[model samples]
Target chain A: MMRLRELAHARTGDKGDISSIAVIAYDPGDFAFLAEHVTSAAVAAHFGATVRGPVERYELPGLGALNFVLHGALGGGVTRSLALDAHGKSLSSCLLEMELPDPQAPPAAP
Target chain B: MKTVRIGSGAGYSGDRIEPAVELAEHGGISYLCFECLAERTIALAQQARLADPDAGYDPLLSARMQAVLPVSVPRGIRIITNMGAANPRAAAAETARIARRLGFGGLKIAAITGDDVLDIIAAAPWKLMERPDETTLALGDRIISANAYLGVEAIVQALAADADIVITGRVADPALFMAPLVHEFGWDMEDWDSLGRATVVGHLLECAGQITGGYFADPGYKDVADLARLGFPLAEVRADGSATITKVAGSGGAVSLRSCTEQLLYEVHDPARYYQPDVIADFSAVRLAGDGPDRVAISGGRGAARTGMLKVSIGYRDSFVGEGQISYAGAGALARARLGIEIVRERLLLTGVRTSELRCDVIGVDALHRGPGTGAMEPAEARIRVTGRTDSLAEAVRIGNEVETLYTNGPAGGGGASKSAREVIGVVSTLIPEAKVTPRVSYQVT
Candidate 1:
């Protein structure tokens, strides 16, 4: 299975304690597949301890983008967080490691 | 083809001013907008105001206006900005003073006020959106500033009154750009679609150089050229809610679909219902195409009627951050740094230093990603960083004292010790009814 980064790139934003990470595909054709596989549950699980709240994903088919809003992701945000990266700006790179169903390899073992 | 060219001069308060100067001189545009306020900035400005009456507004307001006004005036480019920070009237006066000093004495400036809801917020019951249990007014003694997110109506009114420059305090960031679109096109305020489209353009341009490739560089893979001289963005917005994003010639950075896409999703929570003071903009249907080099054409934004409520950014003195960092080098550096952190951790507890939260990290090792980040080849050096949150400055100082004490306390060749204890002012969000805030604009002559 290929890493999600092979098919897409992501950018992240923070509001208070929450961070919104938008994953945009390199090719518009791969968007449908990423959208289908990159579930909120999966992304939340991937981030694990870094993200402390529920995850909500919003789809933008026109732009082939998925916005995953991670609540309580900033470790109390910049004003309060003692974390080195208070804004969680690099969290998007960590998310790019998520594994997806490799198109070349016959899907996930059904 | 009724079109308006608007250029972003500054994004946040400390954004690069040289690019703004370049945009003012080179980018031919009717309106120049500077969005220079953040969530907790007003509180800090309020604190400054408490210390000095004439120093509440943005520190760079005069400098930016001085650089931009002369160029903008000759071109008849009207300036709109939220550089007012805590005090719009003061900021407008400051801008006017700068304009007069620059020999543009005929410039008319307007300040939109009434966003400050301290009196209302203090008396009325409002709950913090995050911690619903704690009432906003309950933190009365700790509260510093409370400003509502004003909309475009006040800005449109100011522009209609023939103000050459509009200075405001705590208006919605996107509204800084959207106001010109509404005033120039005379787009109906109730028309959600047009507002939505303009909002899209505003969002893209609000962060200044972000959409123009300042923040999109990834080295070899997603390379952006000449980022050091990155030019701010300018939008050629049409009457039909369509715009072309481009930058001035002889400037740095690029305007690509990737750059635009990264910015398009920046800080956006929901793609379908992006809420603002004026409208609920929908980016779901929005379309983007690469019109040419350094040019991306965008359209198809849909907007719905606005919510009756408006967001209020409340700033309060949260706590204090006490931090200390000391470095160690050579072969056994990692082990020494780890020991240093462990000592600071236990020392803080032993000293009975009041701490709300404590964090110990080895900077070159696990500080960022929680483990040996990007270091397959053993690090030659490492740093120990210990930070703690405390209620009082005295307690905060104690936390740093322990780290400084480590210098002689031993950790093997530890040097370059730095320590600081600073007050932390945090911002919280709350919603208030739109009727409570009556945004009114008044003008002053330079």
Candidate 2:
């Protein structure tokens, strides 16, 4: 297993209660691998209860990036949220902790 | 191919000033744009304006102009900014005063107005975009400010009129950078593709140092050199809408393909439909290529027609919040911090404090990312934070007061206790028809 951070870098932006995170692959060759493993359901499940609304994902093949818009993610927005990181700027690193199967590893003797 | 160079001066209201001075002095550019307003900034500025008539603009306007005008004005580098916040006329007048004091007479400064649509918003019933069931009337007197995101038309008009400095209130962030392109290239307002490409350039350079390795340094993963004195960004934009993003020679930070790609999607939701007042810009097909050291080429930005509707940011008084923090160190510090939080939580419940929402967090452990997949490590030191949202300032104060009492009564080794309570300013959005808003420009010469 390999951490997603080894394959991509991410940044986070917030508007109201919605948090938008874009995960971009380091190499264009890894784009398809990231797309297959980093599903919206997996991201939503990774965030668990922190994200109260549905997670919508968009793909950008030309840029080799995936944009995830997490609704109701700020705990009622920055102005009202009591979270230490009101903007959820660090949430991008949290999403990077997802473990994925190593493509370089040989297939388990079938 | 004719190309124009534009420099990004300031990213936000409180950004570093020396980098902008460096841009004005060393960076060979025709236009210098400063984007200084945030979502909740105008609302707070409006409250200040209500308190004092001449104090609604950005506090650092004089300082920025004082530092940049002498160098930028003499070199014929036009200045464009949204630093006007809640007051552009006053900001322009102040800039003119600064220019005159600095012996730069006959410098024309234009202030773009009509972004404030409080009367239009109050007169009609518009549905709130965030809350569909609610209307403008639902906010009522609590609405402190309503400023529409203006397009590049007013800024373009000011630039065309030979204004040396153009100050605006509540223009779109990207429009501040794109207006100069529109004016220099003579791009028609109906040219959707050109406008879209210009928007891409603006978005990339709008954040100043973000694209120049300010926010992108990861010790081992992505190493950026000389970040302490990171230089701001500039773009050499062509008449055909393609551009190369670069910074001043020998300045700190880098302008690589990685930095460009990271900033291309910064604060962007859907890459294909980046909604701006000028056009619905499409960046899904945008490509970045490394040209040289500290330079990257950008292309493939397209756009469709605008939505004909303008988004208005409505700022209202939401509620009050009270917070308190205390620290503990040495062995079992995490245990002491957790015990302190539990004590404060129980005290607030026992004291009958009315709170709509409350959060108790142990800093350095799970304050930012709570719930599953957290709390696997034990730290030698920890800080306890107890924050609560209440309807009134008085109730909010009590929430903090309860936590402060924990320093002496509840937890052992609790120290450095601090508490604060303040009123919250909430921001929401609604759409208004384009015809209902009008932009006007007035000039002041030094």
Cα lDDT of all candidates, in order? 0.88, 0.92
User: Candidate 1 DockQ score?
Assistant: 0.65
lDDT of 1 by residue, A19-43 (tens): 9999998888998899999999999
lDDT of 2 by residue, A77-105 (tens): 87778898999999988888889999799
Off by over 4 Å in 1: A99-102, A106-110, B371-378
lDDT tens readout by residue for model 2, B275-377: 9998999999899998989999999999999999999999999989999999999988988898898888888889898889999988889998975657778
Model 2 ranges with Cα > 4 A deviation: none
Quality class of the docking in candidate 2, CAPRI style: medium
Per lDDT, the best of the predicted structures is 2
**Full-model lDDT, candidate 2:** 0.92
Question: Which candidate achieves the best DockQ against the true structure?
Answer: 2
Accuracy of chain B in candidate 1 (TM-score):
0.97
